[model samples]
Target: MVEALKIPTTLAELEALGEEVTLRIPASFEEYLEWVDKCEFTIEYFNNEIVIMGNASYYHEKLVAEIIFCLKTIFNKVTGFSVLGSNIKIHIADLISPTDFNADVSVVQGNPKFVTLPSGKKSNSKITNPVLVAEVTSKSTIAHDFGDKLLAYKKIESLQYAIFVSQYQPFVTVYERKGIHHWELRDYTRLEDSFVLMGQQLTLAEIYKDIQFEK
Candidate 1:
């Protein structure tokens, strides 16, 4: 854990760290927003701490693009659905520690409901409603993405599906909400495998398309 005060102020300085870093500092959400806004890279808020996100690898970006394309293709003709990229921020409220996260791919089934930051600033960048969220996991972020982040996403009232896709391999884990507190889990490893979300089917081949994994 790094101290927020010791963290670098510029994107270049932070990128010099060469990996994602979590800093613990006592600061208001307003300050966090201001700090992150100054940097060019992605930054996430979790439990009052700020996580300086690492740069995406080639495979990671490829997978993200593929997933977004597949999702958009599936919901293209559907009414009231939009697929979003990683740039959008998701506000996970009602938790002991509210979080602001950026998913690799997110799907909103209705007109997006935006929210104001704790600083009382209104921005379309922040969304509180998403029906589905996807994370492209890497070696450094696999744990947090699977653990605390997944739990926080499940808390979102509008969220019904959470998908975790591996960048290094052809594997994916999907969690479907079954009840108020129950979720059904499914894993897909083969390219031929597919899953249904919100009545639309997506194949693993579509997600891993154009991505090559090392043997």
Candidate 2:
């Protein structure tokens, strides 16, 4: 018989397991939030499972920073827009199962809305509204970034644009909400390529500035 996996009880134990490790052991949303509060690393909750997202790679971190910088520069003088980093947790509401994600970068128009955790406490770490969310994809997280996470981001009513950037290459994919249930996809592979986000033009050159890809 297959043995059941043990759930981690301490932050040290959870961190030792490393990144992208998904624990299928049954867990409640409250239990998952408790882990989120205790653990230093980022953790995701979905379908009653807790996924431990350990430290990102060097290029992963660099790419995320670059994207954030480019976005901030674009909206620096613009009002009613706030650029957020990965530290913020985005709550994906309207789904049957509880879902939360840490995007590489998030852009919110107007005031950001905070979500109440299952503990009945308000959390600044969690936000409910983001018009644009970006994710830096690596080999370890590419599946979740493009699959489950992408689908969940669409369900977020406040989300309009979802950007995915590759750490291994100068490639970026954008999903723009075209209709209530329709989305338009655009891909950029060259440094000169640019895309319109929230009516602002962003080129790949700026997003991948100072970024080197392995050949």
Q: What's every prediction's RMSD, in angstroms?
A: 2.2, 2.9
Task: Say which candidate scores most in lDDT.
Answer: 1
Task: At residue 39, give the lDDT of candidate 2.
Answer: 62
Output the TM-score of candidate 2.
0.90
In candidate 2, which residue ranges exceed 4 Å CA deviation?
1-25
lDDT of 1 by residue, 64-181 (tens): 8889999998898677899999999999876456688999899998789898766677879989999999999888789989987898998898999999998889899999999989
Off by over 4 Å in 1: 1-4, 20-26
State the RMSD for candidate 1. 2.2
Candidate 1 contains a number of clashing pairs equal to 0
Q: How would you encode candidate 2's per-residue C-alpha lDDT over 159-185 as one tens digit per residue? A: 899999998888999999999899999
Question: What's the true lDDT of residue 11 in model 2?
Answer: 63
Q: Against the unseen true structure, what C-alpha lDDT does each candidate score?
A: 0.84, 0.82
Model 2, global lDDT: 0.82
In Å, residue 202's CA in model 2 sits off its true spot by: 0.7
Least accurate 10 contiguous residues by lDDT in model 2 = 1-10
